[model samples]
Target: MNDITPADSAERRRRVARAIQRRMVAHVAAGGTTDFASGPLENDPAAYTDPARAELERREIFLKVPLVAGLSRAVPRPGDSLLFEEFGQSIVIVRGRDGVLRAFLNMCTHRGTKLVRAGADGTCERRGRMTCPFHAWTFELDGSLVGVPGRQGFEGIDMSRRNLIQVPVAEWNGIVFVRAAAGSDELDIPAYLGAFAPELAQLELADAAPIRSSSLAADCNWKCALDTYGEGYHFATLHASTIGVSHYGNVAVFDDFGPHWRINFPDRRVKALVGLPESEWPEADYGGVHFLFPNTVVVVGSGGPGGAFVRMFRIFPGQTPGTMSCRIEVYALRGVRADGDRAGEFAQDDAESDVTREDYRVAVDGYANLVSAPAGFTVVYGRNELALQSLHRHIARAIGVPL
Candidate 1:
């Protein structure tokens, strides 16, 4: 195979989009046919309820690996900063004056106080330096300690030792990744992504811009909430009035790249291609539901009344199995849409509504049964629910657990 290069990336995207479109079109023509596994997979319910398992996942999957912080556009400028908080830990990611991306503990060396606060717009705006709210200790954008209010009080201490504590950070294909645990290994994005790097590069996310966002706390295992995104099997019932009205139910095309995968369920609109020539087939706005291993769901699709948008959900484990927090951010590719575009707004709003109001409500109620159910109880993923089944398999391998 020839090496994938930047020049051919756009062509690759066109090819990927067309291939997915063909798969979706064919499935729709076949009356909602979808890929299926050879047999049903019985997954342990305790995987979601076991405190030990949850903690193990927290360390093995989330903390041990790099976590998606935000888009590179978040801190585009030299002095720009972003505060990333998850699992009770906060990290400050910034670009130095020299244009290098850097991340550090969001702490003041003097007293461990948070160093920066977001402005009214929810972005870290600073001059050339950051000042701690507690002791007024100042640090440069690159995390260098630049000043101390009480210099004479600590004259004997080495100023260099008092700089902000740095953490692991890397930028790739427009995504910003950071490791909250200082003891974790340094980031090697290419090795971390493996074959998925070329696929991500094709998206050209480096130029995508956020249009709108929302965050929510839910009562359920993070995996449970995540499983909801893996299939359209529930669209006909759970989302009958929302997503079901547009997308076909129980129809999807699944492609796996290592632990990462993309699943696409045809929308009713694709039926237009049923009798049309391949040359007349319309391009797919929503390429597919893309899952970046561990925890992030990214889908590039239409916003309904809004237009083209990229919707992302970053799910984080709460302190226990019964709790999880989610952050949803919708972005628009440059020139494809504008800031304050209703398409992006509607997409984010409708998505947040569908996930929180509908799916999460069911998860909350059903999880109760899971907690009280008998020890032999197991959750079954039918042959048709391959995406969800695959997710469980990936999680098992990542955390060294047998599913």
Candidate 2:
């Protein structure tokens, strides 16, 4: 395979540079709400690289935020339930018989054992109770410890008064959220979602069930993994072999919403977006990318609504100073009408998923090299780095660390 010459890179890089300049200038000229010059957490270096500092954040910031422990997706039916771990706490998300979404700590009150193991499907034996396998401790779907294996073991044990710990949880825009600490106050999920709420509310994501799910552990910083996504700046070179012609938009249009951020761009291959002049670019059919506070990133469009043809979610973690685990969720719009009949939704979804996996492989390799350096320094983030900066600042503010 022929490598891209310096001249080819220069030409494409120049185009991307000019696009970013224009977008930034226009955003400021229009009096956009974000202040990119100096954000609240712009200079906090400890939050990103310090393990001890990150631990404090893991306790107060991540646990109480309501963003980390929420229900990401759910089915409205009563039997539907989901489980995930967040901020070192195991969370159980279930829909009660009244079809209310409830979240509880997945722990058995006896011996302080974790009731459910990881990767197990959700189940509730009673209308509101889930059974513990270790000691056969049965808990209500709502977390009430209604049954114990032996009544004779404890003469005065009050099962009625001994219920499984319930955590504060709220579901909004089809995603469920939880607060791990006991006696923690409820969070306004809608407000916490900030600007992304409008678009999310329109998605109706709960109507869709996860058809397939996969996770991968990588030896790289969580932010490093997430930063590799969003911008198309590296596409032409990094993905030259497989995805050279499918999409376009090497430019990134970054918009900040307090701690949340959104990045939008037009795929050059999409005739709906590419045919128009750069200034008149259609925002309606163009692709959109959104980051939910800290760890969730979704790419939509180039396919249709919910990107009927495309949808990908990235869940990454700060496993260590330099290692991260990322889980990618890919879903294709099933039984949805498309504006165009050019490609099948499932085929397009699979193709997009492949591209993402390829990107992950390359990024992890790059991260390994960076962390191995003897004298570590800051990595330079150019105009394409706005989304990352936005995320970093948000994390700093949330942690109450100086930015």
Candidate 3:
């Protein structure tokens, strides 16, 4: 898929509007029957509890797959860099002076020391150089080792071969993705996105900028944390005090875009769109929750005090099998009051924290009970939870596990 032009972008918006209209009409006619999968699905408990299975997933799913590392705005300028760990691999994403975004293993060439230890993300003002703190070994943003201290001590060493190891990196619609494993230069991000590419492109994420970001360490398996956003079945019960007032209960429209899925939840105000034409329909009428295969969820909702905003939840495997880390970034549309504004950004974070904290609490409790349950314990996915089933099935296929 190609980047959406202005005409294509407007047409895509209309397409989404019409699709939402059709779903709303069908929903009203059906008296609130939710979209469903072929049948209920069961997941093996070992997928979440077994260390051996976790290791397999780390290889096949996390390392082999193209994982979203950060947003384009994270390194918007040529000298900016972001560092983070994914599945035990520390990665550095830097923008070169030539305006190219590249990713490398965040290790020193001399003694395997980390090149950037300031924090998760920072800006490099040395123009084209990344200096290792240990020995002051310098490298260009393109991963070329340009300066090495005590060069005479290593007479036969080839600086070209000692440059930082370059990993597979690609950017699609302002989202940066990297393959952490070595020799993974052939991963095609667009092909990995499949049918979901166009829809993501329609969001015009490249034009939107991040206003605020935060990370949380959760006490649950990575899949468990991801499962929280795959379904709306718990909205009324789990989020009753938070977001339940605005959304309907257990009602959603589901679409499978290849291995990924999109779930649209009609809020209480959706009924107002019954008589409006597609052109008059607003995109904010429906809450769009998209699962970008493997480990990301993009939620589009009202911007609370401003306009609409997109919240991206990038989930990663923690140090242990039963833990996970999540980085949430909030991006506002252009010309919105919240765009690049600190106070508006704080409001977005506060709103997200309210709902997310509730979800994480439930996940932690559920994981505890799941692991302690009797042998052969399994988790059942209701037909309404089709996205959740799709996620597990994709992971199973990737790791050579049976359904």
Candidate 4:
């Protein structure tokens, strides 16, 4: 073996030391009780929804933060890939023979061709290899440019020099996340996950099959759509038809872990959570909302020692100023079923039709009015908007965009 340089040895030792220190801190923290507090988000016009300002903010958060790109699983095994678009970049994620997940920009190197024409639903084709219909430039699942039709015309062209551009990607929590930034290594996914990584690991999302998946586009600024989901205060008024069973404004708890925050809506189980007076309250109602930074929201319903169910929200920004898209997924413990489907599964089916329809109608109406408001902008975020503020602040800091 080559001699190890002293600097390299020192660097290795430092990394090991940090890992040990992190574990020790985690052990001590785990031994103690935990508390969650809500953080404040200011109404910053420059960051929230301004077309010019939002563009700069989005670039930093989506392109600079090596967040979701490092922790989501593309494919759990070999020969699998997922194609999607985000942040004005077409992305293709694939699992190589080594079982490593990799991401690439979907643009073809030659003549600026789009390597993968999106399928009907605007997702990956999922076939073995992707073929560009424009000139039939074929790329393997690993993103190597394998063939160029009619190669005789371009003699001495180095095929190896023409491989597809690769994007940064990492896998954690059974989800695949891609970052459009170039020259970025695998992000420290677990650290960005903060206190929730361990809790998330227990879910075994890689094994959890998605019963259904749907995407919705709303005529609202992306932040507006995200804001709508961050708080439960709207449940009583906005979601009255669907979430009426759940009481709001009764008891709430908030917790922050630097960039991450969790806003817990008092579940009916605890006496304090009982909405009515102690005399009229019953036991056994429970739920909470866990908001992750950079646009991933998970709502959890209390089960017992473990979680009962969770609904996932993945928000994507549209190229236009006032357009946004969202993906919703619901998962539950294995073998748990309700009305022939998994307990949380039914809610997911209704997400697009009922839940999303309600949210969409409100979002479109809300943004249209905000943009058209005579006074220009008058926005209100009640105390229940605490988590929304927290999210905004985290996003602001990550993107260097103030709001």
Candidate 5:
């Protein structure tokens, strides 16, 4: 792991990009990881197969820590919201008329049925208020109860106390995060982000717009499926026919800010930068996958410089340790989406989908084995798989477990 501290500056990005390019070009020449000394760690198979441990992670990590809801740009205007139904609970992350983002338990104040039904894309369309599908109870974007049907029938019902219950919500850079449990002061995202804050800002996510979105369901542990996104070692065997053809396999650059990281499997085209002067190197294709701690991946698409894009992957644990779901949201800078020259329009929808399918196919099959693997077998992360190692390590520390 070339654990360069993640920096917030454009110069740092430029420098880091060039350095990674140079390093990757050399690795392409050497055909293996040689710069870092970190190594293969065996993790207990029980971690992925144990319901007891999965429940612990659910309580400590998923519910306690702030989880990614969606992009801020998805709800850029007042009264916009999306249903974030994960962990068997429904919640709505909404924006108010006063331009503040708030989250509410999706239950109606009257009968406890879901008040908002999201469209096929997980977004809700409302001018400023949402009425319950069951009782026609109305709520403002800020979750204040405004109107009630049959008010006289239900006499002495205090509307003030019937407001929608609120949970904590925060917007950092362009990412919107929510804590399932109710709390106000604890969701300091910037503080939680720590050194990763500046690196996230460089993506300019707040100014971007959502283009497309999709979801994946897999029969594997959530962390097992998530590990697929943290390393490039599998490209040679697993993605050989896809990403392997265009990008070098088993080679990458790693940088970290606490548990968060930026790991890139460089473009083979970067080999052109090997002997050339650094000043003459083009800055158009310097990109990497940024891993937000716990469960989110922001792939800063390197489809040339001006036409920037990002793909976000948010994974959620299922009821059992052997099942999980993932949400994939694609976004691009506002103007770039409208530009005629936007890059990889087909690649985003087709090629990336193919790659994700390949990843989960293996994860599900491997998980099947782990489920029955002798209560003692282990999963190994190779010497070069630094990001995966750090990820599991952080999860263990967070849940008070020994990895």
Candidate 6:
């Protein structure tokens, strides 16, 4: 983990502010518009409808790649724990009493019963000691099987050899990452982030706590739901009644950070920073949307009159190719108390859900149409949707398939 001091945090914010100012200036100089890609990109329709390819992705990408299991705040205390089911694998992320975080299969070492079960929305509270409900088997937070009922029946059984299976886990910039498959190499979060590390570190996510989380089932592929967020092209037409009123249409700054990408969409408020000095410009005047490689999208914006907030979207493949699950987590700066904070948080949550529902509605319709589309059908991603193009390319490369 990188030790980021106050000076480092301030410097990162200043750097981002300067970069945005430069882009704004260049946009004005070039006739008040953002740049565009050379041409549109095309993707095969089967990439979203193929069951065989989805299974391969489940093994190669979902299992092998480091996925954002949850935020650091999900297990803030030493005894805090949570269960995550991704790609059909049950994972338990826990913070041990030694102040270390670890991941393991959420199963009893004796007889393989699930150690814990998530609530309706796939979330649960911390458990100091995990006990399998099926049998009287108990285990510690660090996946050490300490007690087993009916031990006399299993004579000469080595307890040390029967510890719960451990999965590779790491925390970076307040995000928890896990690799579910056994014997997989440790996921180096920093190395994987590459040049984006410094920028992501600037978000100061560790200084925030998750305020609310909710999930919705979508009648579309996981990628289809994710594609809705990779571009702002639909804001004017699809979101005209909601976000489109406050945000500009089809105007954004795009940049690549390794396999990840970021799209900065300036709201009507961004015009206020046009002539201001770089030092005086607000750090988060624009909506900063970051697409973490593979599955997560982090959207950062101002929290009303004070503080800041972030909304993270994690999309996972469902039981079939035509279904997907989307989880949204909203977080705010820790220790920042103000009047009507709860009201403000609830308002934000409602507003986000309203806009997200619109996106999903369109995506679901698109998916249904694609399933019945004629042969040789292909989806075209306009130049304005470069992020989608890049994301599809990475997915194809990971699954060894052609887009």
Q: TM-score of each candidate? A: 0.93, 0.77, 0.92, 0.76, 0.92, 0.93
Better of 2 and 3 by TM-score: 3
Clashing pairs in 5: none
Report the lDDT tens digits of candidate 6 across residue range 1-403.
6689857886777677568757855565454476577889898778898899889788878888888888887888987887777556798888999989988888788888888888775567667888899987988888888888888888988888888898899999888989878667888988888888877788888877777788789889888999988777788899898788887667778889867988876566667766777678656543488888889999887677666788899889988889999778888854345757756877877887888999999889999998888998899988888888889889899999977
- lDDT for each of the candidates? 0.81, 0.59, 0.79, 0.60, 0.80, 0.81
Model 1 lDDT tens row, 1-403: 2255656876887788888888888888888799888899998898888899998898888887778888987777888888888654788888899988888899899979887777766777746888888988999887888888869999888887888888898888789988778756789888888887777777767777776667888889998888888888999999888788878999888888877888988878889899899988765564678888888888877555545567788999999899999888877754345445764567556755665578888877777789888989999998888888888998898889999
For candidate 5, the lDDT comes to 0.80
What TM-score does model 2 achieve against the real structure? 0.77
lDDT of 5 by residue, 121-193 (tens): 5677866788898889999888889888889977887779899988888887778888887544458887778
Clashes by residue pair, model 1: 306-343
| TM-score (C-alpha) between model 6 and the true structure | 0.93
lDDT of 3 at 115: 90
Clashes of each: 1, 13, 0, 12, 0, 0
Clashes of 5: 0
Ranking by TM-score: 6, 1, 5, 3, 2, 4
> Least lDDT summed over 10 consecutive residues: which range in candidate 5?
1-10
* Candidate 1 Cα outliers beyond 4 Å, as residue runs: 1-7, 303-307, 335-348
User: What is the C-alpha RMSD, rounded to one decimal, of candidate 1?
Assistant: 2.6
Q: Rate residue 393 of model 4 by lDDT.
A: 65
Q: Give the number of the best model, judged by TM-score.
A: 6
